[model samples]
Structure formats: C-alpha cells, structure tokens
Target: MNYMKNKRVTRKKEKHIKILYIIPSKTPTGPHIAILNMAIGISKNLKMKIFIITPKSFELNYKNYYEKLRESASIYEVSFKKQGILYWLSLAIKAFKLALSKHIDIIHTASLKILIPLGVICKLIPAKLILSLEGNPLYEMFEFSLFNRMIIILNWVIGMRLVDLILPCSKWLKSEMAQYPFLQDKLSFLHNPIDFERFQNAKPRGIRQEIGVPEKAPMILTVGRLHPVKDIETFLKAAEKTVKHHKNAWFVIVGDGPLRKNLENITKQLKISKHVVFTGFRHDVERFMAAADIYVMTSVYEPFGLVVAEAMAAGKPVIVTNVGGMPEIVGDAGLTVDARDVDALAEAMLKLLKDEELRRKLGEKARERIEKSFSAESVGERLVQIYGSLLKDERQ
Candidate 1:
C-alpha cells in the first residue's frame, strides 16, 4: 500500500513523456501490426518514451522484431493466461507499478477486452486512455451467453466513458460508432497505416512464382482470415461464375482460420478447386498482394480494410464490398459492389480482368492515394503529434 502511494510520487519526479501500449493478444493481428509499425516509425524520437505491453513468450516467436522495437521502446511481458482471478490481479498490479514509474502519458488499448481493465488503471494513475476500436465490438460477443454479452456491453459503455481518446480507424467508423453518445464526443479519425517499407520491399520475386501460379494467367487475390465475417464464401461463389469465362484466372487466398476447411470444401463443391489456391497465413502478405494482378475484399463489416489499402500501396487495382470503411479506402480508385452479392462481385471481377487500361489507371490512382495519406512516415508523424497534443493539453 505504501509502495502504491510512493509509486505515484516517484512518477511525479520524472519529466520525460511516456506511453504504455497495452495489447492482450499473443497473435499477429491488425492492432499488433499497427502498434509495431507505430513503434518503429517513432523510434527516432529521443524525448517521448514508448513501452509495449504484451503477453509472455511473445518475444519467443518474434525475437528480432521485438528486439528492434526495444531499441526505442521498453517491453513489459505479463502472464495473461486465463488461469485464475489472482493471476490476473497480480499481472494488473505489476502493470500498474510499471505505469506509475514510467509516468505513463498514454495507455493505448486496441479493443474492449483490454479497455475495461486498463481503462481503470488510467483513472487510478496519471495517464490518459486511448481506446482504439479495432472492430465491431458487438459482433465479437455474438457467440457469448446472454449474461456474458450484457457484461461486455456494460463494460464497453463504461470504458468509453473512461477513455480520454476514442479513435476509430476511418470516418465511416466515426459515423457508425456515433450510436453511442459517449463515443460520439470522444471520437477521432486515425486510419490504419500500411507499412510503406514492407509494401516497397514486397519483392522482386512474385508470389505466383513461389506458388506455381501461371505467370501468364490472371491472379485474383484475397488476403484475410477465412472467418465468417470476412464473407469469403461469396467470393468463392463469385469465383465459380467468374472462372467460367476466364479459365486462366486463378484465385489465391493468403490466410488461415477456423473456416479454412469449410472454405476448401466449398471450393471443391463449386468445382473451382483447380482454379483456387490457399496459401494459409504467410508472413509475406505484401509480396502476394504485389504479385497478384488484382485484389479483392468481401467483408460484411470491415471497420477499415487495411489489406485493401496495402494492396493499393502495392499498386494493384482492387475490388471491395461496399460496406463499413471499405468504400472509404477504395473511394473512387477501385471497384465496389454490394456485400454478399455473388453476381455483383463476379461482374466486378470480370470487368477488372478484361480492361487492362482501366486496371492500370485505377492502380496508379490507388498508389498515389496511399502515398499521400496512408504512408508509414505520415502516420508516424501524425501519431506523435496526437500524443504531443494530448500531453500538452493535460499540462495546460
């Protein structure tokens, strides 16, 4: 108890601004990738300190990458296994101590699960909570029980109230999330930035060459998890019709998930197995996006189609479902069709496949848009500016 009280006083003696990034998952996800890139992007900042909070053993799989990040930032590993109440309570205590010492300027949490706990920490400590809504929060509770759903909903409402900053990745999300009165006042825009370095370095070696896809044939590409919300079944149904006219066209999916087996079975049933390839979760996603002739996104509820933007950065023309923030990303640069409409998706694919001139024009426009808005350097500077503003605002 004395330690907790003195921890606050000790933090007051520090002058350097610090940020504590809280990410609960040990998986390679959008928020994980975003925070990593953000860390690397702002590495040269000598004044502002950044620390990443991740699950234990995260460094085991990503040693070099984490080491590189640690050059500019510190890492605090916590055991987040759903073992027991005491285990989590202990972890929280440790995190609180760390934040107290660092005089944490910001506590950035990507989802609601992290938000609820860390949001409390923000109130307890001299920190500002930045809650980034990574996806549809309600959709995440779809499989939960009625009681569990209610609990999460309450937490979300309270968490939004606690947070100092609420960033939705796109303007569409900003508008969509306005349903909640608390979120409406706190909301700000911060589109997920693509790692421009990775996109540029995607490869001189095409993914087609690696996967044995014919160099002369058109490659239709999709890069996302084989999840239900992704609505990949419609893409396959569209492929069933699109492949009839363009037999040389091959569809490549570069992700893995629970629905992989189901998607494979659907491909076989559609009788387009010969025309489809699944490259189950490659680290080199940008390489595949660059190698492809065109990119497609068919999500029913994409908060922001980060992959679609990456594909655009890769200078590939894209076709995306007109839902959520997909249209905001694609804008006038790519083709858009109704979500789950197999006929519309197939027609859009066919149109892009046939028009070489149209494809090149759109691809050029897409790349330009990415460089201007979604580039790594731009995102890094903008994030740092936001951080600076938040800290400065509080001091005032």
Candidate 2:
C-alpha cells in the first residue's frame, strides 16, 4: 500500500500528459493512417507520453512501425465488440478502468463510436476528451450501413455534450457540422498533415519502363481504394475515350478493394484493357506517383483527399471531382471536373497530357499551395494549439 501510494505521488508530481489514443484498427486505411501520423509527430515534437488503445480484434502487425512509435510511447489492447448492450457495458467498464489506473490525462479517439461513452466516462472523471473527426459522422454512417446511421446519431448527440474539442480534417466537414447548431463553437479545422519533404524528394524513375509503358508515354494515375464512392468506373470509362485519340497514353489505377474484379471486367468489356493497368494495392505509392504525369481523384465524396495533397506535394498536376474538400485542397493548382461526366474527365486528362507547359505551371502552383498550408509542421502546430486551448479551458 505504501509503495503504491509513493508511485501515485511520483506520477502526479511528474505531471506528464498521458494521452490515450483509441482507434478501430491498425490497418493502412485513411483514419488509421492519419491518426498514426499524428501520434508519431506528437511523440517526436512533445514531451507528453501517448498510449495507443485498440480493440483486441485489431491485428498487431507492422512491428517495425510500432517499434519506432513505442520508443517514446506505449500501447495497450482492449476488447470492444461492436454488438449487444452487454458488450458496450463491458467496453465502458474496461475503458474507464484503464483511464483511471493509467492516469490518462486525455481521451483521444479516432473512431467515432468511442467518442460518446469514452468522452462521457472521461468527463465524469474529469479527464479531457479530444475527438479527431477525420470524416463526416453522418455521411460515413449512411455510406457503411443503416445500422451505423443510428449509432452515428446517438454518438453525435453525446459527443456534442461531452467532448472537449472537435478536430475536423477539412473546411467542408467543419461546415457540414456547423449546420448542426450544437457543434458550432466546438469545431476546429485541421487537415491531416503530409510529409512534404519525403514526397518532394521522391524521384520519378524506372516506373514507366517497369510498368511496360513507352519511355515518353504520359500516364494518368489514380490511387485509392476501389470503392463505389471513389467513382473509379467513371475514370475507367473516361480512359476508353482518352485512349481512342491518345494511343500512346496509359491510365494506371493503383490500389485495391472489393470492386477489383468488377473494374477488370469493365476494362475488358470496354476493350481498353490494353490501355489500362490495374495495379492492385502497391505499397510503393510514392514511387508510382513519382512516375505518373498526372494524378486524378474522382471520389463522389471525400472528407479530405490525402492522396490529392500528396500528389501536389510531389509536384504532379492533379484532376479531381469538384465536390467535398477536393477543390479546397487543390485550390487553383489543378483541374476540377464533374464527378459523373466521362467526357469531361477524359477532356481534362487529355488536355493536361498534350499541354506540357500547362502541367508544369499547375504542378508548380500545387506544390506552392501545399507548402503554405498542408505540410506536417503546419498541422502539428495547429494541433498543439488545439491541445493548449483545451488544457486552458480545463484549468478554468
């Protein structure tokens, strides 16, 4: 008992900021990637200690990445089954105990579901609750399943009541939440940061030759999950039109999803298989982006297009749909087209392909915009300000 008391006293005196980061999984998906980057940045830039809290269902691969992260932080696994009242009750109990025992100063969640109960539980203990709203809760819920819609609404209500801070990835997302009167003053816009230096240093070499394209072939590249929202079918159909005129040009779609076979079948049916290459889930996206002449994003809805910013950072001209946050991210650096119009997309791709000077001008502008707003250092500074604001509020 005396030893335990002395340990608690020592911890309180040290007063290290203990942040418990909760995420759904450790996958290479969007939310996971964004949170992992933030955690790494914070660990390197600040003196605070971070503890990653993930569900037991999450796989523990990528030891190399985790080892680097663990050098300055710690990790814990908690089981959180997404079903039944009993499961939720158990999860709440476990999380509450972890927060209390670990002396967690901040409860930070990347997943939307954890925000409600986790925030409430922490607030009862008076721990700070910080939610990184990476995507739109309402839109993402409806996109996944109707069941999620109910959960999203419930969580949104509780989140507004309990969360101390809201971090949105884009202005569009912040505007969307502003429609809800409850979230007005609580919302803060912070776009996910990109390692601009790494992207800028990437060399565009050998990819055209390895992918079997002609040395001078202009390649249009789209890198993302092959989902319906991504509207890759539109890009593929547009490629059919593009290839009819630009015979030496090629369209490369990198990344994978449930729709791979469907997209492959469409390529065969369109008879443009020879002009298109579906390189499923290449880990070397930087290498692919380096080789590509143009980067395209046709997502019908994107909370924030990380890859679009990455492309601009790489000094590649971009073509994206004029929806969600794409236009804001691209600014005047790239072309925007109607999401569903095949001919329009085809025209933009072809226009950039033929106009080398136009591409160079756009690419230069794109890099400049990213340098001003989307660099990792800029994002880190914004986040630290948010954390300081929350800390100030708590003291008062």
Candidate 3:
C-alpha cells in the first residue's frame, strides 16, 4: 500500500505544469490586466501551478483584483523603486530562484523591458521563455527619442532570438511582426481575454443625470485616452455629423491624456459642444458602458482593442476603425469603418441609433461572440494547448 501511494503521488505531481509570470507594474495597466486574467484562467482550467511576481505596491493598489487572482495562483510581491536595469535584474534573480526551487516549466512576460533579463535567466534554466507582444514595437519605437528607439531595436534583435515563443495579442500584430523573417518561426497570435463577470454585473451609475443629459437620450460612448493615435478628433468630428441628424443624441468621451485640451478645442470648434461631454479618466468604465446605447473605437492604430471586447462584453453595439485587430475582434457583431472617416462613422452611428431592432440583434451577437471567443476559459484552453506543445517538443 505504501509503495502504491508513493507512485500515485509522483504521477499527480508530474501532471501539474509550473509557470511563472513576471509582471513588473504597480498599477493595473492593459498588459498587467491581461496577464492577471490569463493567469487566473489558466489556474482555473488546467492542473497548473501558477506563480506571479509584481511590484510590492501592486497588491495595495489593486486589492480586489489581487485578492481574486491570489485565489488562483501564488503571488509574490517584490519591491522596486523604478523600472530601470536594476529592477529588471532583481526580478530576474527572484524569478530564477523561484523557477529553480519550484522547477517551473515556463516563464512568461508581456513587457519588453524585462525581456533581456528573463532571456538570460532562461538560458541557465530548464524553462521555456514566452514573450507576449501587446503592441507593435516597430511602430511604437518612433514615439520615443532616437536613443530610446535604438535601445528598443537592440532589445528586439537580441531578446527575441532568446525567446522560445512569441505570442502577439492579435493576428494583426502577428502579421506586422512577420515582416521580420527571424520572428517567423516563433510567432503566434492570442487574443486578450475579458473579465465578463464584472462588465455583466455592472450597474449603470446614472451618468446621464450627472452630466445633465436627458435620461431617454441616445448616448454614444467611446472609452480610451485622448491621444493622436486614438483619433479623438475624428470621433468629435463624427459626433458633429451625428448630432446634425439625431439632435437628441449625446456623445461621451471617457479618458484623459496630453491631447485633452486639443480634443476639447476641436469639440468646441465643431459647435457640438452642447451634445458632447468629456469625462476625464473614470475607473467605473463598465458603468458608463452599461448606460450607453452604443460604443465606438476610432483608433488610428490598435494592437488588440481590449476595450472593444469590453464594450462587446457589456452587450453594446460597437463601431471600430477598420485597422489592426479591431475588425478581427468586432467580426460580424459590430460595424467597422475606415480610420478618420467622419462620414462613415457618423453614418454607422446613425444606423445603430435609428434601427433599434438592428442594434438589439448586434448587441446580442456581440455578447454571444465575447462569451464564445474572448472569455477567460476559452483563452486559457488555447494557452494550455500551446504550453503542452512547447513542453512536448522540449522533451522530444
């Protein structure tokens, strides 16, 4: 009986694949949220031992999400003053030790900043390193100074070669990275998962009453930072055209950035200021989504429109720019228009607002699509398949 019990214990331990996720962020950003959701999903769906390391302050800042995630994985908090070389080195050392102690099978991270350190550590360990590409590094490089751009390029050339797998968050990003022949062998695409429960349960927070808009007025909502890339100017212009037909329609832009003043000026110039409201940065974005009749994303370039999925999860019909991965996420559930096409955007918004039956059908389809494709369980299953293949190849 003792010998049989010992053999069963070993078999049970072998079935649990260990993965370590290093997310070096104090606040909940897009990459951080994506990692957390993926980790939770993997833990729930697979017999995996999951470990996560983040800045010590992350727990304090996002207590609710942290607690929920802790239930699914072993979370370790590490102190870091700034995201510099020393921080990355510290994270690498911590991860290396944990990987060795736990016999971690895979190490994953979304940030390029820590790629080099993690890559170096992976070379010395038995684990496979997976990099989750959340944005177009080549396109984003131009946003920085010349020296910083060079650093980013160097990181890509060196760090990418060290990674065992490169998982872009969208197929659009995978195609963009495919231009580099070296990345062809390692590249794959994975869509970001959404926290459907939160969005589905969110109660409307009476945003119309707070903003002095009529309760029954049709509300068109767009949630993203007011930046040039997001094309808020186009949204405001589209709103200008939209109000010409539906005077009772209201446009709400929820987010803040350096371009807020410029976008606000554009709203004034459009003479639709009365019909538009700019609510700078609100945490309760789900509540706003709940209150809105329609959702729109006018990004000039988007990697994977996570907010589009969020809006879809909220059961709101979306209008996304036909760029990057927005169309892929929207599929047949919502409308897609050319970026910066104010006329097309206005027409789509009008169509959704005017045809209640069409809006209802699209909204139902949007939620159904999200449940089927973008749910945590679905994403987790895809990830587990990838992990299994990678490990199987390693053994062979």
A best-first ranking of the candidates according to their lDDT comes to 3, 1, 2
Model 1 residue-pair collision total:
0
Top TM-score hit: 3
**Candidate achieving higher lDDT, 2 or 3:** 3
Predicted candidate 1 versus true structure: per-residue lDDT over 1-396, tens digit per residue:
776576556555666668777656666788766666666667677766888877786686555358668677888887756624554566567668888776777887675654567778877776888877766577678866786677678777776688888778888888878877767778887878777766755773766877879988999999998899899999999999999999899999989999999999999999999899999987778778778889999999888888998899988999999898889878899999999999999999999999999999999999988878887667778888888787675554
Model 2 TM-score (2 dp)? 0.85
Give the alpha carbon lDDT tens digit for every residue of 1-396 in model 3: 664455335434587788999888786778778877788668776578899988888777766568778777888878888877687678888998997677778899988877777888777665789988889788888878887787788888898889999999999999999999999999988899888877867778777798777899999999988878999898899899889999999999999999999888888889998999999988788889899999999999999999999999989999999999889999999999999999999999999999999998999999999989998878988999988888875543
Model 1 weakest 10-residue run by lDDT: 82-91
C-alpha lDDT of residue 9 in model 2: 58
Ranking of all predicted structures according to TM-score, beginning with the best and ending with the worst: 3, 1, 2
RMSD to true structure for each model, in Å: 3.1, 4.0, 4.0
In order, candidate lDDTs are 0.81, 0.79, 0.86
Candidate 1 regions with alpha-carbon error over 4 angstroms: 1-15, 60-68, 79-91, 144-151, 204-206
User: What's the count of clashing pairs in each model shown?
Assistant: 0, 0, 0
Candidate 2, superposed: residue stretches over 4 Å from native? 1-16, 55-68, 78-98, 145-147, 203-211
